[model samples]
Target: MPSAPSERPLFLDPNLNIIFSVTLLAVLGVSSIAPVFPTVARELGVSPEAVGLLITVFTMPGILLTPFFGILADRFGRKKVLVPALLLFSLAGSSCSLARDFEVLLLLRFLQGVGAASLGSLNATLIGDLFTGRRRTEAMGYNASVLSIGTAVYPSLGGALAALGWYVPFALPIVGLAVAFAVLFRLDSVEVEPGNGLGRYLRDALAGMKNRKVIGLYLVSVMTFIVLYGAYTTFIPLHLSERFGSTAFAIGLIMSVGSLSTAITASGLRYLARHTTSERLITYAFALYGVSFAAIPMLPGHWLVALPVALFGVAQGMNYPVVMSLLAGLAPTEHRAIFMSANGMVLRVGQTLGPLIMAAVFAWGGMARVFHVAAGICIAMFLSLPLLIGRK
Candidate 1:
């Protein structure tokens, strides 16, 4: 059995408040740029189709690198990898503000994605390291809430900055990363058990892959990103531009409304944490997410559209923490980072595929149909929830 929070000494406690704050900032940094993708593409002289590659660019490196980073974190220490990774995230984010061409921007964005992957997986592992049982569940719920809040705020904030110039959105990460670095420095490092180097790390990762529950959770994570991000990254801006003749500022406002829903619902998610198991909540959350996306195409205009986005935000905020908490629970204590990294790799695969799929849909049927397809994908994922939730 896991130790209770009261029994764990405060000094060595994983200060969830600080950890969550950093996570919020990190997510905010990434999401702020999401709403501004169309504008950035226009400014850089790229097509929306080409610009969609931004998501892929950001996701690919992390997908490729996270397993290694995860193993390193498991073998070395979470703090050792997390702190430096934050520094790298900050630096790359700043460089994004200075990119002179699409190529440079793409390269920098990939590097930034790598940093984000490291931070995201490490944060979950850290939570796993610090808390257990009910406290762990509660922490996971709160983490989900913070992620929603960040998602809620960042796009509008990014949109607001994008009004000044394209680079403004890129600069947001510097501020977020700086804060993350400060928080990371104050945390004490956790000790890791010694391992048999590369061979053992690979073996453990493969073992994690073989676990049905873990694989299901990871697939859910991937599909969640693909559907949520695929739509958000591709259609939201287009929808704004089409329906409202939205400027960057206007787009920010619309996306911010969605974020507001996420932020608001996040506060209450901990209550659900107290009442429900992670498995059950995730199944329900994904079902709600599908329903929410299905509603998007039905909403006729920008003013009414916020309702769907807000609902989606609520589902998203509820889903992630539970999924993450469950992932942490399933992973071996000694290989937490590697397992988390593997999960990230699967998520990136979804991230990579989502945009390409959406772009093709956009080309075939226009923007409105993309949401319909997203709804379909979400429904398929929701159907599989029964298998995942019932697992031991």
Candidate 2:
């Protein structure tokens, strides 16, 4: 049985506060920079499609490196891996503010991605290590809410920063240096028993990932990022800029609207999970995704676009925490880091593919066609969920 809500005040724990802080940094990886993409493209003299590569190159490293980091965390300790990663992420991410050339910026972003490779997975791993049962679920919801809060604040903040100078927002990640030290000094180290040998550990971890349910959840995670990165993060800002002549501040506010909605929805996930199954909530989230994407292309004005953006936020809030909670539950205690890291690996695949795939579509057609196609893909994924995850 799980502890009562009254007995456990979720955010009051120092360990969870560290987890929340790390989660916020993890979010800053993408959200803080997304609002600045248009400004970067304009200042750098890149095409809209070319600018999308900012997202692509930044996400590409995580696909291959995340699992490797996970294994290291499993064998060694979380802080050993996490602290250095945070420092690297902070330094590389902050240096982007100084890059005058586009290629140099891409290189800096790629390095930042390397630092970010393990953050998403490690945060979840820490949550699993520190909490159990309903407390874990509650923590996941609160953590998701914190992630949403970063997403909400970063864009508007980044946008506002961009209005001052295109490079100002890039300097924000320098705060990670402080966070890195906090993790190094303050976060409790999670010790893992070095079970058997590396070969056996690999075999055991891979075995845990082979289940059909795990595979299904992984697919859902991949699809979720595809839509998130492809439409919301990559193209939506461009659409607003090109079609509406919206300022960077306006773009940030628009993106922040979706994130604020996500924060609100995720904050209530504990109650929602009590009333509905994860699969059902996820399915409903996909329906909202489809509707949101379809409505985006039809919006009469950028201000009115918040309706669809808010809907998309609800879908995101519904999807991420549920999928993660389920994955955390399925993960074997001994191999939890690798299992979650594997999910992170696939998440990077989705993030990498989202921009490239949507950029291709944008090149082939236009913004409206890109979103229409995304809506179709969301509906298709929704229909396939029964086959993927099955009726429960």
Candidate 3:
């Protein structure tokens, strides 16, 4: 089903440059702010548990809005949905720097989340549009690698900015505006056929979901984020801070270590894809997640903990691109946006619930227990996948 490669090298492809930019900007939502959570909690007079709401509220809107945005993209055209969403994301997200109160900051983050709801799904949708076979895999690997770069840099950038003031990191979303301008003026629109009708489109898309394998992928997506947001992104910084009194800059550096490893693994995904099935790679990813997570809470010091974090990076780098490429391959061309958007919706469900549920775990058992519990969940998921998704 895959098409032949373009004459131009992937790096020279302008369309891909735009997609990579989108991927880079998309990660700014969480990674840029996470290292600052402890600082926020201390400065704003809230418990660390309450600060977790920052992640929760930002992800909540995507759960409800992504499907509709997908439908709109499928109907009107991708740019029609993407440009406005980028504008909204930039305008609302950057405004957070002005908020003095926690409630006000949450409200701003919710609005920014609305803009973000479609970005990830659309980013993947465009890949499905342009490339196929090994080309698509290479593109997915590069896109994910860019995402890894964003994740790796933003925390350190954020932590460094947080040193200036707690609110300074919030101002960084302003860069989204520049990315939005590039997307609007430079990124060529992918052609989209207007569907038969909204009702008919919904029917066909729903029919695609009836496939058990597709459903299994969605379920896998949910569990993957639960462990990621709950254990890695949401709490690990807190764990470092509370246990070792690590500074925001120090926490960011430790967090970036994992992301750096992820970028390295993702850059090599094409070779990995040739050697093994995506399903097997994903299985191995969860295994790495369990091993890394179980080890993190037991490590004796902050800097030493980077060892396990690097292992978790391998899991993350393997998990995201493989799952996305498989999903893109499975989705029908006509309904790909909605199908990918549905993936986005479930991802939000995982992201939203991850911190809230983990917050409960943190409240009950404290920070160290959170990683131990998440480790158990990853192992359970690794075991359960064979049953839910029959071997390809």
Candidate 4:
């Protein structure tokens, strides 16, 4: 049971507030600036592709560093890794405002990605530590709900601030610093067993992932984000502007529709899980994604664009927490941090690949084709789900 509170807001007893709030704010480093890339390109006298690297550079390092961060969390304790990572995230994120050159900004973004790495893998580790069974399912739902809300809130906040100036959005990271301070004071360190040497850790990681069910979950992690981030970090804003003459605010608001829908879906996942298995939930979610992306280009107007985007959000909301919760079940507690961190690394790989691959597709056949290709990939994955998941 989560500890009961005596005086502080009740969630403080379990650090749920700290977990939810910090994880929510932790992601602004990515979500806040995505909509502002066009304006940043203009201000920096760089191509939109160069500006897109702001997203990519920040995310790319998460792929490489997540395992190291995972090992650190397991060895040093989650809070020990978390506190300093939060500080780096705060500093690097805020430092983006000071960057006069695109290269320098990319450097800062890469460093920020490294910091961002811990919040994800470790938070999942912490969740696995704190809750179990239905409670863990419920907690993962709340975690997804917070993520969905952040996805909804940050882009709009960044867009509004970006309208003031490209530099203005950079100030938002200071708020993350405040959240970091809260976490520093509030979150307790989880005690962990002594870690085996790297060879053993690697052996254990391979052993767990060798399970076909776990392998499928990791593959789902890669493919799902490829479609979603491919859309989110790159073309959708530009497409909206071309079709609707959208300002940053309009783009952010339209984007928020999908995330808001995700929030609603995630908050209700406990109930959803009651009726279905995670495997089926994930398959259905991907099908929804395939259909939604295929439909995005067919949108006749700004409002109609949201119809497909909302469906994508539902897919993500239903899919992500279930996948993570399922992964927690599959992994041993002793090595959970590293296992989940590997999951985090694959997520970064997908996030980076999504935009780069979609860019190539957009170049060849434009936005419609991008969605078409994304649709095809999702459908292919959906069709192969049974084989990929195999026997548990």
RMSD of each: 3.0, 1.7, 1.5, 2.4
Quantify all predictions' global Cα lDDT against the true fold: 0.75, 0.90, 0.89, 0.81
Candidate 4's TM-score reads: 0.94
Q: What value does the lDDT take at residue 362 in candidate 2?
A: 91
lDDT of 3 by residue, 109-197 (tens): 99999999999999999888877777887888889899998999999999999989988888877778888888888887667778588
Off by over 4 Å in 3: 1-4
Find the candidate with the highest lDDT and give its number.
Answer: 2
**Tens digit per residue, CA lDDT, model 2, 126-212:** 898888888898899999999999999999999988878898888888999988988988887557767799999999888889999
Give TM per candidate. Answer: 0.90, 0.97, 0.97, 0.94
Candidate order, lDDT descending = 2, 3, 4, 1
Candidate 3: worst 10 consecutive residues by lDDT? 1-10
- In candidate 4 the C-alpha lDDT for residue 77 amounts to 76
Superposition error at 157 for model 3 (Å): 0.6
Q: Which is the better candidate, 1 or 4, if ranked by TM-score?
A: 4
Lowest-scoring 10 consecutive residues by lDDT in candidate 4?
Answer: 1-10
